[model samples]
Target: MFSRLANVFKGIFSLFIKDMERKNPEALLELEQENLRKQIANFNQGLAAHAGLAERLMSQVRKQETEERELHARTTAHLRAGNKSAAAQNALRLQSLARELEENRRQLAQAEETYQNLTKAREVAVNAARSKIEALKGAINDMRMKTAMAEMNEMAAGMVSTIGGSGDTLSRLHEMVEEERTKAAGRARMARDSMDMSEVNIKEAEMDALADQALAEFAAKEGIALPGAEASVAPEANRSMGSNPQSESQ
Candidate 1:
C-alpha cells in the first residue's frame, strides 16, 4: 500500500516535470533549483520542529522532575507527621507522572536524533542538486555552441559548393568561347586561302582524267578502237624534247 502511494506521487511529479519542460525548459531548470531549495527548507524546518519539540519536552521533563521532588518531600513530611496513607497516595501519583515524563523525554530524544540525521542528508542533497544544475547548464551551453558551429560549417559548405559550381561553370564557358574562336579561325583560313596553284594543279589532274574517260566513252559510242593511238601520235608531234646543239649545227 505504501509503495502504491509512492508510485502514484511519482507519476504525478513526472507529469508536472514534463509540463514544466514543455512550457519553458529554462524556467523549468530554475524551478528545479527552486524545488531543491524548497526541499532543503522543508528539511530544515522539519529538523527545527523536531528539535523544538525535544526542547519543549526537555523543559517539561525538568518541570516534572522538580514537581516530583517537591511531592516526595511533602509525602515524606506527611509520613513523618503521622499521615502514612495520604503520603503513600501522593507518592504513587508523583512516581507515575515522573515515569510518563521520562518516557516522553526518551521519545523526544529519538526524534531529535532522527532530525539531526535528516538535516545532514538535506545538506548533502542540496550540494548534489546544485552540482547537478551546474553540470547540466554547462552541458546545455556546450551543446548550443556545438550546434551553432555545426550550422556554421553547413552554411560554409553550401557557400563553398556554390562558389565551386560557379567557378567550374565560368571556366567551362570561357573554354567554350575559346573553342568557338578556334573554329572560327579555321573557317576564316578556308575562306582566305582559296584555291592556290598547287590546289589548281591537283584539280587539273582530276579534269584530265575525266576528259580521257569522256573520250573513251565517245569512242565506245562511235565504235572506234584507236583512241590510244591518236593520243600517242598527238603527244609525239607536240614540241621538241630540248633546245638541241646538233640542230644548231645542222
Candidate 2:
C-alpha cells in the first residue's frame, strides 16, 4: 500500500512537471540548450585528455627513434673498432626500441582516430541540438502570434454579435436618436405653422417704404433726376384731376 501511494504521488508529480513543460516550452528549450553546452564541455574535457595521451605517445615514439639512431651509430663505431660484444649489446637494445616505437605509433594512430571520431560526434550532436533549438524558437513565436490572432478574432466576433444583437444598447441608442430627431423635426414644423406672419409682413412693408423715401430724399438733395419720383407725381396729379369734378358735384 505504501508503494502504491508513492507511485501515485510520483505520477502526480510527473504530470505536474509535464504540464509546466508544456506551458513553458521556451524555458524547457533553454534548459536543454544549457545541458547540451554542459555535455559538450564535458566531452571536450575527455577529448582533451585523449589528445594529451596521443601527444605523449607521439613524444615517446620520437624519443625512441632518437635513441635508436644513437644506438645504431654506437653499434657501427664499436663494430669498426673490433668491439663485437658492445656492438651486439647495442644492436639488441636498438631492436627492443624499434618494437616499442612501433607499438607506440600504433597506439598514437588509434588515439588520433578516436579523437577525430569524438570531434565529429560532438559537431554532429551540437549541430543537431542547435537546429532543434532554433526550430523550437520559431515554433514558439508562431504559436504566440497565432494565439494572439485567435484571441483577437474571438473578441471581434463577440463584438460583432453584441453590436448586431436585437434590442442591444447600440440598437436602443439608434432608436432613441431617431425618435428624438423626429420629435425635434415635428416640433420645428409646429412652431413654424403657429407663428403669426401678419406683423412680420407689415414690418417688412414699412421697412421697404422707409428705404424708398430715403432714396427719393437722397436723389432730390443730390439734384438727381428720379424716374420713380416722376412716376409717383404723375399718378397723384391724375387722381386729383379725376376727383375735382366729383368734389364740385358733391
Candidate 3:
C-alpha cells in the first residue's frame, strides 16, 4: 500500500513537472542546451585522452624504429669485426624491436581511427542538438504569437458581446446622452412658450400699419391707380359738390 501511494505521488509530481515544462518551453530548451554543452565538454575530454594515447603510441613506434636501426648498424659492425656472438645478439634484439615497432604502428592506427570516429560523433551530436534547439526556439516564438492572437481574439469577442448587451457602459452612456438631449429640447420649447410676447405683438401690428400707409403714399405719388382709391375719391367729390351749390349750378 505504501509503495502504491508513493507511486501515485510520484506520478502526480511528474505530471506537475511536465505541465511546467510545457508552459515554459524556453526554460526547458535552455536546460537542454546546457546539457548539450556539458556533454560536449565531456566528449572533448575523452577525445583529448584518446589523442594522448595515440601520441604515446606514435612515440613508442618511433623509439622502436630508432632502436631497430641502431641494433642493425651494431650487428653489421660486429660481423665486420668477426665477432659472431655480438653480431647474433644485436640481430636478435633487432628482430624483437621490429616486431614491437609493427605492433606499435598497428595500435597507433587504431587510436587514430578511434579518435576520428569520436570527433565525428561529437560533431554530429552537437549539430543535432543545435538544430533541435533552433527548432524549439521557433516553435516557442510561434506559440507565443499564437497565444497573444488568441487572447486578442477572445478579448474582441467579449467586447463585441458586451457592447450589444443591455448592461454595456457605452450603450448606457449613449442612451443617457440621447435622453438628456431630448429633455433639453423640450425644456427650451417650454421656456420659449412661457416668455411674454404682448410687446412683440403690438410692435409687429404698428409696423404693419406704417407699412400700409407708406404703400398708399407711394402709390399716389407715382400715379399708380389702386383698386380702392377710385371709390374713396368719388365719394369725397360728391360730398364737396353738395357742400358747394354755386359751383354745381355753374
Candidate 4:
C-alpha cells in the first residue's frame, strides 16, 4: 500500500512537471542552452589543456632536432681532428639523439592531430546544438499559435451553439410578427369591403354639378367669360337661365 501511494504521488508529480514544461517550454529551452554553454566551456577547458600538451611536444621536437644537428657537427669535427675516442663518444651521443628526435617528432604529430580533432568536434557539436535549439524555438511558437487558434475555434463553436438557440427565438418573433401583419392586412381588407361608397359618391357628384351650374349662371348673367369653360356651353347656359323665369310662370 505504501508503495502504491508513493507511485501515485510520483505519477502526479510527473504530470505536474509535464504541464509546467508545456506551459513554459522557453524556460526549459533556456536552461538547456545554458547547460550546453557550460558543457562547451568545460570541453574548451580540456581542449586548452590538450593544446598546451601539443605545444610542449612541439617544443621538445624542435629541441631534439637542434641537439641532433649540434651533435652531428661535433662528431664530424672530432673525427677530422684525429681524436678517435672522442669521435666515437660523439657518434654514440648522436645515435641516441637521433632516436629521441624521431620519437619526439612522432609524439608531436599525434598531439597536434588530437588537438585539431578536439577543436573540430567541439565546433560541430556546438553548431548542431544551436541549430536544434533554434528549430525548437520555431516549433514552440508554432505550437502556441496553433493552440490559440484551437481555443478560438472552440470559443466560436460555443458561440455558434448559443446563437443557434437565440436564432429559434428570433424565428419565433418573426413568425409572430408576420401573423400579426397578415391579420392586420385581412382586417383592413374586410373593413374596406364592408364600406358602401357608391351612394355617397353619387351625392357628392350631384352637389358638385349644382355648384358648377350656379357659377356658370352667375358668369353668364354678368357677361364674364369664365376660365376653362367651353364658349358654346356658356351661351347655352345664359339662354337657359333667361328662360327659367318664363318656365316657372307657365
Which candidate ranks first by TM-score, i.e. highest?
2
Clashes of each: 0, 0, 0, 0
lDDT of 2 by residue, 1-250 (tens): 9999999999999999999998898899899889988998999999999999989999988988899899999999999999999999999998988898899999989999999999999899889989988999999999989989999999999999999999699899999999999999999999999999999999999999999889988998999979877887899999999999999999
Give all TM-scores, in the order shown. 0.53, 0.80, 0.75, 0.70
Which is superior by TM-score, 3 or 4? 3
Residue 199 CA displacement from its true place in model 4, Å: 11
The digit string of per-residue lDDT tens for model 1 on 99-137 reads 887897798788778877877887788888889999988
Please give the distance, in angstroms, between residue 185's alpha carbon in candidate 2 and its true position after superposition: 1.5
Worst 10 residues of 4 by lDDT: 162-171
Model 2: residue 180 alpha-carbon error in angstroms: 1.3
Prediction 3 global C-alpha lDDT: 0.92
Q: Tens digits of per-residue lDDT for model 4 on 55-169?
A: 9888888888888888899989999999999999999999988988888888889988988899999999999999999999999999999999999999999978876785677
Q: What lDDT does the true structure give each of the candidates?
A: 0.83, 0.93, 0.92, 0.92
After the best TM-score superposition of candidate 2, give how far the Cα of residue 124 lies from its true spot, in angstroms: 2.1
| Model 4 CA lDDT for position 151 | 100
Name the regions of candidate 3 deviating beyond 4 angstroms.
186-250
Q: Candidate 1 regions off by >4 Å? A: 1-24, 42-45, 167-250
Question: What's model 4's TM-score?
Answer: 0.70
The positional error of residue 65 in candidate 3, measured at the CA in angstroms, is 1.2
